[model samples]
Target: MNQVIHTLLNHRSIRKFTDRKLSQEQIHTIVKSAQQASTSSNVMAYSIIGVTDQNLKNELYKVSGHTHVKNNAHMLLFCGDLHRINRLANTEDNQQTIDNNLESTEQLIVATIDAALAAQNAAIAAESMGLGICYIGSLRNDIKRVNELLELPGHVIPLFGLVIGYPDHNPEIKPRLPIDSIYHENKYKPFAEQEQFIEAYDNEMRSYYGNRSSNTKLDTWTDQMIRKFSTPTRMDVTPFVKSKNLNKR
Candidate 1:
C-alpha cells in the first residue's frame, strides 16, 4: 500500500508525549489541512481553538481530569461552531429566518459532522509529520465549564480536543473488528448473522489485551462494550446543548 494508507492503518492513540512542542509552521499546516476537509454545502461551520496559554491549559486539565491534557505539548479544541456564520449571514431582513435555521437539529448534526471530519484530517496531518496525538473527548464531561474557560459564545460547542506532540513511547495498534463483520454488501446485516464473527473478534481482542505491553488485561471486546454502555455517561450533554440554543427543534 501507499504511504497515506500505511499511515492510516498504523494509527494509534498516543497518550505519552515528549516535551518538544509543535512549531508555528507545523500548527499552521495542520489547521490548513483540516480546513480542506469536506463540509456540507460549504458552510464550514466549525472552529479550531489552539490552547496556548498555560493557565487555560491548566483549567482544561482540571475540567478533563486527563493527565495527557497538560502533558501534551499542544492542545486543540475542535468546535461545532455556527455562531460565526450565523452572525455574518444574518441581516435585518433575514434575522428571524437565520435564527430559525441555525437552531434546528439538522444544523447541529451538520456542524458536528463537519468538525469531526476536519479533526480527522488534522490528526492524519499531525501523524504524517511524525508526531503523537490523542483525542480528549472527556472534555465534554463538563462542557459548560469548558465553554466558560474557552470563552465560547452561544451556538458554538466544543465537540472534542486533540493533543499533539512528539511521542515518548511507541504503542501497539489496537485490534479492530474484521471487515466481514463490519462491511455489508447491499442490505443491512443483522447482529444475529454476525455472531460467529463477533465471537472470533472477541477472541482476537482477548489475546490482544492479554499481550499488550502496558496495562494488560484479559478482556473481550463485548465485555468492554458492556461496561461502557452499562453506565449512562454524560447525561448532561443534551441539557447543555439545549442551553446553547442548539438542537431545540
Candidate 2:
C-alpha cells in the first residue's frame, strides 16, 4: 500500500493526550501542510486562530463537551471567512465585491469547503507526525458565544475547532459506511438501501460498543441515534449564521 494511503486508512480519532508541548517548528510545519490543500478559485476564504489561553479553552471545551480539549497542547479554530475579502473589495481597493455579499450561498459553500479541506490536510499532517487530533463540531452548539470569544467580524463564521497534541492513549479505528452506501456510479440515489445498511451498522456498533464498555449497560447504536436526533441542540446555527449580515441565498 502507498505509505500515505496506509497512514490515512489507519487514521482514528484520539481523545487522550500527553502533557508534552508542541514545538514552534512543529506548529509551523503542520500549518504549512494544511495550507497546501486544494482551494476553490484559490480564494482561500478561511482563517485559522491558534488558541493558547487556558480559560478560553476551558469555556470552549465545556461548550463542546470535550473536557480534554482544555488540557491538550492547544486548539486551532478554523473559520469560513469572506469578511476580509468583502471589506477589501468594498473599500478603497476598488475591487469587485462578491455579488450579494457574503450572504450568497455559493460564497459560504466555498468558504466551508475550503476550511474543511485545509483542516483535513492539517489533521493528516499531524497524524503522519505521530500527533493526535479530534475535531470539535460542538463549536456550532453556541455560535454566538463562539463568535464573541473569537472576535470574528461580519461575514465570517467558524466551521469547527481542532484539538491537537501528542498521543497519551491508542484508540481503535472505527468502521465506516460501506462504499456502496455512499458512492453512486453515475448519479445521485436516495435512501433506498439505507435501512438495510443502517440495521447492520447498528448491530455492529452495538457489539463494538459492548466490547469497549464494561458490561454495565447496553450501549446500543439505537440509543445513540435516539439521543442525538431527539434533541434540538444545534438549531441556533441558521439564525447565528445570519448574524454575519450576509445576503440571504
Candidate 3:
C-alpha cells in the first residue's frame, strides 16, 4: 500500500498512554498544523484550551467519564468559539453585528465543521509523529460544568476534548464498512448493504472486547449500540448547553 493509505488504514483509537509528557514545542507544532486546515468561509470559528493544570484536568476528568484524563498525557478542550467574532466586532460606540447564537440552524454547522476539521487535522499530525490521540466527546457529559471550569464566555462552547500521548499498548484496527456502503458514485443513495455490514462488524467487536471478559461475554457491536443508545446516562447536557446560551437549534 502507499504510505499515506497505509497510515490511514492502520488507524486505531488509543486510550491508554505512557507517563511521558508532550513537549511544549510538539504542542505548538500540532496546533499550527490544525490551524492550517481549511475553514468554512475563511471564518476560523474554533478555539482550543490546553489544560495543563492538574486541578482543572481533574474537574474535566470527572465530566469526561474520568477515564481518558487519568490515562492520557495531554487533554485539549476544543470549542466552537463564536465569541471572538462578536467581541471583536463590537466597539465602544457601536453595536455588535455578528451572529453569535449557535442556536441558529444555519450558523451552527459552520462552527461545528470548523472545529471538527481542526481537531481531525491535529489527530493526523499526532499520529504521523508517533503520538496517539483519542477524542473524548464525553466532555459534553456536563456542558455547564465544563464551561464553568473553563470560564468559557457566552457564544463559546466546548465541542470535545482530545487526549494525546505516546501509546502504551497497540489495539487492533477497528473494521470499517465496505467502501461501497459509504462512498457515493455521483449522488447519495440509502446504501442497501447496511444490515449485512453491521452484522459482520458485530462479530468483529465481539472478538475485540471479548479478551477482557471473565463471565458473560461482551455484546456484539450492534447489541452494544442498542444498549448504549437506549440508555440516558448523560441527560444533563441539553439543558446545560442551553444555559450556556448555545441553544444548538
Candidate 4:
C-alpha cells in the first residue's frame, strides 16, 4: 500500500500525550485540512473551537471526564453549525422560508454529517504530521453544560472534541470487523449468513482482550457490545438537542 494507506492502517487511539504543544503553523495546517473536506452542496455547516486556555480546558475536562481533554497540547471542539447559514439567509426577503428550512430534521442531519466529515479530515492530518489524537465523545455526557460553557448560540451544537499532541504512550491498534462481514456485494447480507464471521471475530477479540498490554480482561467483542447497549447512555441528549431548537421536525 501507499504511504497514506499505511498511515490510515496504523491508526491508534492515543490517550497519553507529551508536553509539547502544537505550533500555530501546525494548528493552521490541521484546520485548513478539515475545511478541505467535502460538504453538502458547499454549505460547510460546521465550526471548530480550538481551546488552548488551561482554565477552559479544565472546565471541558470536567464536563467530559476525560483526562485527555485537559492534558492534551491542544483540544478542538467540532460543532454542527446551521446558525451561520441561518443568519445569512434570513434577510427581509427570505426570513420565513429560511427559518423553516433550518429547523427541519434534514438540515440537522446535514450539519452533523458535515461536522463529522471535517473532524475526520483533521484527525488524519494530525496523524500525518506525526501527532497522536483521541476523539472525546464523552463531551456529550453533559451536552447542555458544553453548550453553556462554549456559549454556543441556537442552531449550533458541539458534537465532539478532538485532542491532539505528541505521543507519550503507544498502544496497540484495535482490530476492526472483517470486510466480508460488513461489506455486501449487491444485496444486504443477513445475520444467518454472517454467524461464522461474527464467531471468528469474537474469538479474535477475546484473545486481544486477554493479552493486551493495558487493562487486560477476558471478554469477547459481542459481549462488550451487549453490555454497552444494555445501559442507556447520554439519555438527556434528545431533550437537550430540542432545547437548542435543532432536530425539532
Total clashing pairs for each candidate: 0, 1, 0, 0
State each model's CA lDDT, in order: 0.92, 0.82, 0.78, 0.92
Cα error, candidate 4, residue 145 (Å): 0.3
Off by over 4 Å in 2: 90-99, 213-217, 220-223
In angstroms, give how far residue 57 of model 1 lies from its true place: 1.5
Query: Candidate 4: where are CA atoms >4 Å away?
Result: 90-93
TM-score, one value per model: 0.97, 0.91, 0.87, 0.97
Candidate 2 structure quality by residue, lDDT tens digits, 45-149: 899999989999988977787777687986899999887777666554354345365677777788999999999999998889889999989888888899999
Compared with the true structure, the alpha-carbon lDDT of candidate 1 equals 0.92
* RMSD vs true structure, all candidates: 1.1, 2.3, 2.9, 1.1
TM-score of 4: 0.97
**Which residue pairs overlap in candidate 3's backbone?**
none
If both were scored by lDDT, which would come out higher, candidate 1 or candidate 2?
Answer: 1
Off by over 4 Å in 3: 90-97, 100-103, 191-193, 211-216, 247-249
Q: Per-residue lDDT of 1-249 in model 3, one digit per residue for the tens?
A: 886677677778888899999999889988998999999888898999987888888888887775768667787789987777666755644433354444565566677889999998888888888999888898887888888888988778888998999998887666665565667678875646466766777777677667642334777876777889998876886666566556556
Candidate 1: RMSD over Cα atoms?
1.1
